[model samples]
Target: MKILFVEDEATIAETTIPAFQKQGFPVDHVETVRDAEAALSVYDYDLILLDRVLPDGDGLDLLAALRRAKDATPVILMSSIRHSVAERISGLDRGADDYITKPFDRDELISRARSILRRPAAMSRRVIEIANVVMDIEARSLIVGGTAIRVARRELSLLEQLLGARGRIVPREAIERNCYGFDDEVSVNAIDVSLHRLRKALVDAGARIAIVTVRGIGYMVEETV
Candidate 1:
């Protein structure tokens, strides 16, 4: 999962980012609301971890604006002001999908993140579309411009990781974690080989989307002419 964490606290930022990364989620963070908006404008994220109070602005206002724009990305509000039922309701009413008190369980939070990522619309759906190419998740099928294309399971797994990142650049380690699990033998060449196959399959299918490799970084999938 690709996530944006909007918080100003240094200690919290340092601790949470690594913890979430350890759980296989790639995260980008900003200390102020303005930076958060800039991040949102430039990139797509699967989930947002927003703090209610910020140094520059209220996180609720950001949540409201995103909802007003019809952005349905899941948001989990974190706040110390979650003392009253009214406060809780206000946060939820403003558009947060979930809310957690300031002091939270890391394991529980990780589980919640996993659950949110595994939403029905994101998971159960057989096909995922990016530009003209559609990935049939269940059948391991790939269709581009109405033509069917075959792909290897590992290639499909890599595709799913890219899709799940919601267009953000996903790192090689994250690709390994999600695509292969803890038990599988992971190698740098493994990811490279699978991605090469995926790219070839998409090109062979006349796909309108291409996976762009960010050298010394990661990969992002985007529409192509």
Candidate 2:
């Protein structure tokens, strides 16, 4: 899944962004509420890590605006100074899915992020199964016909997007946004290249699923009869 990390601390961003990338989640980082809004307007993210303070204004204002617009994207409000009970309550009352204080463990942050995604309201299950293929999202592993398959980070992100759709077409634009970070220098044929490798890997693993291209449109995952 794609994530928007609205953190200004250089030290934290340096470590956290790589951690999320290592887990196969593409992250777009923005330091200000204005930049976050601009990024939100262009891309769709499965999770948002919103810092309570920003250079321009309080991050809660951005969260409140999103809620006002009826955007239900799961958000984890974070702060280093606002760790009081009342502050946490205020954040949740402002429509945050969760609240986390700074100086937290990266693993714990990731765990909490996964927890939010698995919630019913988020619509992202920990495990997704279609036909004989099973994807353990938390494990970042894919199993087909009882055999484990290894996929690259970008390919895994792509697989998540397609498989999460459950045989429905995933638009090309959506795929591009979901699989790449803001700083990534993606090639013109990056999607096609990654997809080709993914298709080969699945076939080599004897999977009974197919990744179909829609020509001038997008792609879909289908079960082979």
**Per-model RMSD to reference:** 8.9, 1.8
Model 2 regions lying over 4 Å from their true place: 123-125
lDDT of 2 at 177: 83
lDDT of 2 by residue, 194-225 (tens): 99999999888888889999998899999998
Candidate 1 runs further than 4 Å off: 124-225
Per-residue lDDT of 177 in model 1? 55
Per-model TM values vs. the true structure: 0.60, 0.91
Number of colliding residue pairs in each model: 0, 0
lDDT of 1 at 215: 91
lDDT of 2 at 90: 94
